[model samples]
Target: MQGVEFAKDLIQKEIRGLELLFQSLDEDEKFNEALQVMSNVKGKVIVTAVGKSGHVGKKIAASLASTGTPSFFIHSTEGVHGDLGMVEQEDVVIMISNSGETLEVLNLLPTLKKIGVTTISITRDKESTLAQASDIALSYTYEEEADHLNLAPTTSSTICLVIGDALACALSNKKDFTKEDFHLYHPGGSLGRNLST
Candidate 1:
């Protein structure tokens, strides 16, 4: 296949996968509960994940932090080492894992609970250990990836990113976050200039 056709196919496949994700969100009520939990967080939203999910988690944390919610990404492996101290009792943890069984993520759960921190999970498997252990779980199930093997995490990661955005937006709306508030956090980029004007 030509490069253009390949790109088009990938985009189309991702669109379909996102459509499925939207449908899943519509059917699940846990998303709203998760948002409510996050909206009430008295401290930062601690985002954690492993591998590709970790990269997505970082973006999610940045999105949340910029959009009126205080948040930061803590690599699961790093958390176990010493970064876990950054998490406080008032914070809410959002752990991301497509399978919901990432060892690093799961390992931090008990410690979080012991510290009196609330945990939220974004995962494809509601029954997975991470989901079951979380105070709230936002399901982000996807049918398949755009790649032929369906193992590159294209679709799943996209859905995860969207879910993170959804949560950030919801929290921002709840807080009545205005463009002025956004500008305070982002005062150097084009976005800052746009919001300032």
Candidate 2:
């Protein structure tokens, strides 16, 4: 029963954190700017991050790619190892970092700029180095973690995932993406079967 109670408490905390995220996004104009930048991207959307943020980045990239936007995820550490060639001048890079101070992510910024790539950052800290360097920064802030120790990344990572979905959905709507278009990319599942008919 104690474990069940703990689980319930964590769920409640995460819900409250999500509410805060929505409120903050409503007040931040950068959210719209970030969407605009993504919508207008002439080349692919390159997403990069390290650690757990990298996991979230991969999902974000996939969401964007399946929803009419061409996107791919690159590990920040790998970017320094010649994978940076995957990035092009016209591309827009979406870098994710909770602290906004990930060394590998920061290290790639100069080269991204040198190649004229626009950067959009998703981070909790508006004043973080990642946010400061970004052409557009989508800030998501929360007061507490769902985890009891507050050491885990439960809340912040959820915020990142939700924001990434918002970006993908917003871009899809802006581009008038339809079920038919989605089917073209996702043609191997129940969703594809539904879209076909």
Candidate 3:
């Protein structure tokens, strides 16, 4: 395979997915609801997922925390094995699942409901079980995956990361987060150096 040719196709697919995601967000009022939950939460934002979504979830949690939202990530499997203790009734939990029916993610809902936390689910299926179960559902549909095989999580995870960034930015705006607040949480990196100066 010509590497450049393959890369161009993949890049085009990713761009297309982002376009669709943007359109979906414009039409979805639930995005605003999720933002309200994150903005008003007196507790940390807890993000959970498994597999590729888990990796994306970690970044989402980190972005939220650094932007002054106070957040963290927990593997759904571990949440079941006692990590859920870290979550609180006041916390807002966000779950990521490409298919929206991931068993590991779904398995946590019953307990989360009992714990009385506000739950949000990000998935491609708005009507999925996980979406239906959560208090707020953020869903988007991408036409296809980036690779020729069309079997990887590339586009899906990219879109999820973008969604997380949007949420973090929204909350940051709502809270009037400034460079000073950002420096407080991110004081050791080049980004911190730039913000501090």
Candidate 4:
């Protein structure tokens, strides 16, 4: 029962954070700016991150790609080696860092700036280095993580994922993405099977 109680408490905390995020989304002008940039992107959306955020970024990239946004995820470590070449001047890059100071992701900024691609960032603080350096910053406020220790990335990462989802959905709708378009990119899944008919 203690473990179950812990789970419930954690879940509730995260839910509360999400509710706050949803409310703030209506007031965040940067989100709208980010959406406009994404909608106008002529090249692919490149997502980069490190640690746990990197995992969430990969899911975000996949979601964007399948929903009519051309996108791909490149690990920050791999990006510096040669993968950064995949990014082009027309691309829009989205970087995620909880503290907005992750060196690996920050290091990519100089080259990205030189490439002259638009950059957006997801972080907890609008003033964070990652946010300040970005063309637009989509940020959130959370009291703490949803764990007993309040150190894990549960809440913050959830917000990042939600932000990514909001962007993907809004952009898809703005662009008038159709069921046929979704089916075109996702042809092997149960979703695709259903859309086929």
Candidate 5:
């Protein structure tokens, strides 16, 4: 299965990139600050993305919310319509874009900037427009599995999802978020059944 092999190699490359990123953050101060910000959050973690990234953003928002970080997903394309009202100055925005140049997301960058919302961008390109706009840029770039034929998103999306998981767990640990806290937010699925009394 050549396709399977390709997938495995892609996964390995992504894992390597993530390993490097985690190793580079050996000093806990930056991470600690992010955690503290999450713990003291007065509003929700608003996750935004376009296309495939939007799918990942929705899942990430759920993960963070269940882990005790209040979060919600917003479609970037809809931001200008009426969804923009959902964002508050007190909230932190997590923007997801594989190329970091997503048109829908870029279109709303000016508005977000004007409104004074703190943003964190997750992208494969560290120097992308979205990354530059963000207060904190989290890189998910994979140098090895470079699929320039639009297939790069498969690996890149997984990388972004994993990074989101890492952020959620790290913040949960910092806030001492417990299983009970997770259960409170996710009380309808199979996970809720397992966590229920």
Candidate 6:
């Protein structure tokens, strides 16, 4: 019970800090632009990330595709090998990193730049190299003492996942995606029933 409470406390503190980060943005234009990008996507939304963010990216990509926007996730490390070919000129790339300086993600930047694909950065650092390179930067702010587990990525990753969900749902609303579209992406079992006509 104590452990669960501690974990819950950590999550709350970190998430609140993240909310503070978004609040400090002082501009919604970047977010709005991202919305427009998703809405205008001629191909698909390409999400890339490494480590923990990669797991969240996968879920986010799935959510985006299932909701309204067509999206898919590609591991950052694998991108250089061959996954970069998965992206189309018409697609928008969303890169996830807590520090906004992931090497694998950074290495792919040059190619993306050459290809002229719009890139969005979802990270805690607005001044990070990845953020600087991104066409749109959605920065996450964290409070001073929010136990980051050796300042690794525990809290930040959780907060980023929440933000990703918010983006997905907001765009879903904007696109007016029907539940029918959801079932098409999720043809599993009971949950599928909820989305089916």
TM-score result, candidate 5: 0.85
* Alpha-carbon shift of residue 127 in model 2 (angstroms): 1.0
lDDT of 6 by residue, 82-187 (tens): 8899887889999998888889999999999888889999987889999999999988777643564546666677777877888899898987877777777787
How many angstroms is residue 85 displaced in model 4 relative to the true structure, after the best TM-score fit?
Answer: 0.7
- Give the per-residue lDDT of model 3 (tens digit) for 30-141: 9999999889999999999999999999999999999999999999999999999999999999999999999999999989999999999999999899999999999999
Query: What is the overall TM-score of model 2 with all chains considered together?
Result: 0.96
lDDT of 1 by residue, 46-118 (tens): 9999999999999999999999998999999999999999999999999999999899999998789899998
In order, the Cα lDDT scores of the candidates are: 0.90, 0.91, 0.94, 0.93, 0.80, 0.84
Model 3: what TM-score? Answer: 0.98
If ranked by TM-score, best first, what sequence of candidates would result? 3, 4, 2, 1, 6, 5
Query: Top model by TM-score, which number?
Result: 3
Error of 3 at 138 (Å): 0.2
lDDT of the structure predicted as candidate 5: 0.80
lDDT of 4 by residue, 30-145 (tens): 99999999999888999999999999999999999999999999999999999999999999999999999999999999999999999999998889999999999988889889
lDDT top scorer: 3
Number of backbone clashes in candidate 2: 0
Reference-based TM-score, model 4 = 0.97
Give the per-residue lDDT digits (tens) of candidate 5, residues 67-186.
888899999989978899898888888889988889898887887887787788878787899888888777654655435354656667777788789889988888888888888787
Give candidate 3 regions above 4 Å deviation: none
- Regions more than 4 Å wrong, model 4: none
Q: In model 2, where do residues sit more than 4 Å from their true spots?
A: none
Residue 37 CA error for candidate 4 (Å)? 0.6
When sorted by lDDT, best at the front, the candidate numbers are 3, 4, 2, 1, 6, 5
TM-score for each predicted model, relative to the true structure? 0.96, 0.96, 0.98, 0.97, 0.85, 0.89
Q: Per the 3 Å backbone cut-off, how many clashing residue pairs does candidate 5 have? A: 0
Clash pairs, candidate 1, are: none
